[model samples]
Target: MIRAALVWLMLAAPLAAQVTEPDGFRMDHYRDPVPETVAGGATISPEGAYQLWQDGAAFIDVLPHAPKPANLPKGTIWRDKPRHSIPGALWLPNVGYGALAEVTADYFRRGLTNATDADPSRPVVFFCLNDCWMSWNAAKRAADWGYSAVYWFPEGTDGWTFMDYPTEQVRPMAPQPSQ
Candidate 1:
């Protein structure tokens, strides 16, 4: 009985931490173990994403940006953290939030349009970081928006750079005021 109980405890430990995909966007705990499958899109590995990149699939990075703290003392200069992503990738910061503002939604739509040149049929890859749900949410949103070919890279830049792939510094897209 003791040996059986130990084995059961060990097995249950992993399941305790596993997070299942929800029917809708993940509302909290942005950094957590994501579900293996994204309902409406394909979950891609680094190698597969690299191949698609070479074939002209657009990559969108959804890592949120840190806005400068308004409480900073006068004369304090704030510098944004530099983000390095796969080459030719567009960094669409903050669009991966569980819920989006109207402006943010418009920004996302505009970014997708810009990436695909207004073609919904073009393949687009979304990613943020390893174990991040933001990319998963964005990928589902794309598929829901009628994008025919949407790919989600769960491992993101960390996985890409782990394989010694090249990376380039990228800036977030600035949505126009009209958007």
Candidate 2:
């Protein structure tokens, strides 16, 4: 009985942290929320986002700012850097706000502050692993904060990598430790 109970507890432990409320449940835990531009909510599509990139719209890739490992498991990708980024996209990792529940007023402020610090008027595009909530949450948060134009690239890096586009490997700022 003791051993069985221990096993059950172990199995349940990991799941305890995985519960998430649906979108916009709280200021910090929302998923994909409506865009501010449309009176009613608007959904940004991948093709539409791709067109914006091709047309050289002002946008930034908010992946590098991720404070944790990318959701894309290693080995799933052949070469990680995009073969080519959307013509004029800038790289901005998600920093730490990777989920709606993880967000705080400070987190939103920091994201906007960091983004604006680079280019105040630039419309920002956020992304992560394809179909993940991190970028969606980030973009929605940005829009909620009154950013005029916030675009989300749902296809993420995998889409760019699969397309055989140009990409460059950016060395991390810190020195890699010897294996």
Candidate 3:
């Protein structure tokens, strides 16, 4: 009986680890919501994104900004670094996420208005890292805000890079003050 119990524990331990292991650096977590039907606009593929880009779509990157490191040496000089994005994509960080907090919504609205010159008919595409919800939410919000043509690129920057699509360096937008 003692031998059987030991064997069972050994087997269960590995299984438990596998079940509880964190999904590390993978684009598979949080299944793509609204895969078949976007709330307001259509979900697009990498190829479609490229086509829209060629047609002059306004690509928006909705990836959240990584917090800046703190505790640097007082004299440490930080230079402006180039961040990469789909060519011509406006880096509107922090606008994506399933929940449209008032602050985030305002940022999205302002970004759209500023980037597209308040033209609702302008073609717009929203994306982030693959499988992230930020792009999904942002695209929906644009459509809800009366944008006539909105596209959600489900295959995000990863997919774009994988396809060898052109990327350009961009600076992220500053956080807007909360209402």
User: What lDDT would each prediction earn against the true structure?
Assistant: 0.92, 0.52, 0.77
Better of 1 and 3 by TM-score: 1
Superior candidate under TM-score, 2 versus 3: 3
Ranking by TM-score: 1, 3, 2
Clash count, predicted structure 3:
2
Evaluate model 2: give its lDDT. Answer: 0.52
TM-score of candidate 2 to 2 decimals: 0.48
Report the C-alpha lDDT of model 3 over 1-179, residue by residue, as the tens digit.
Answer: 99999999999976742222122212344444335345678888899999999999888998777655697789887675556889888888877665667977787788898778889999899998776766776777788779989898977888899999999888887667657
Give TM-scores for every candidate, taking all chains together and pairing residue i with residue i.
Answer: 0.88, 0.48, 0.71
Question: Candidate 3, 156: how far from true, in Å?
Answer: 1.0
Could you tell me which 10 consecutive residues in candidate 1 have the lowest summed lDDT? Answer: 170-179
Q: Candidate 1, 156: how far from true, in Å?
A: 0.3
Cα error, residue 58 of model 1, in Å, equals 0.6
1-179: candidate 1 lDDT, tens digit per residue: 99999999999987876667798998889998898888789999999999999999999999999988989999999999999999999999999988999989889999999999999989999999999999999999999999989999999999999988999999989867652
Please report how far candidate 2 places residue 142 from its true position, in Å. Answer: 0.4
Q: Which rank order by lDDT, best down to worst?
A: 1, 3, 2
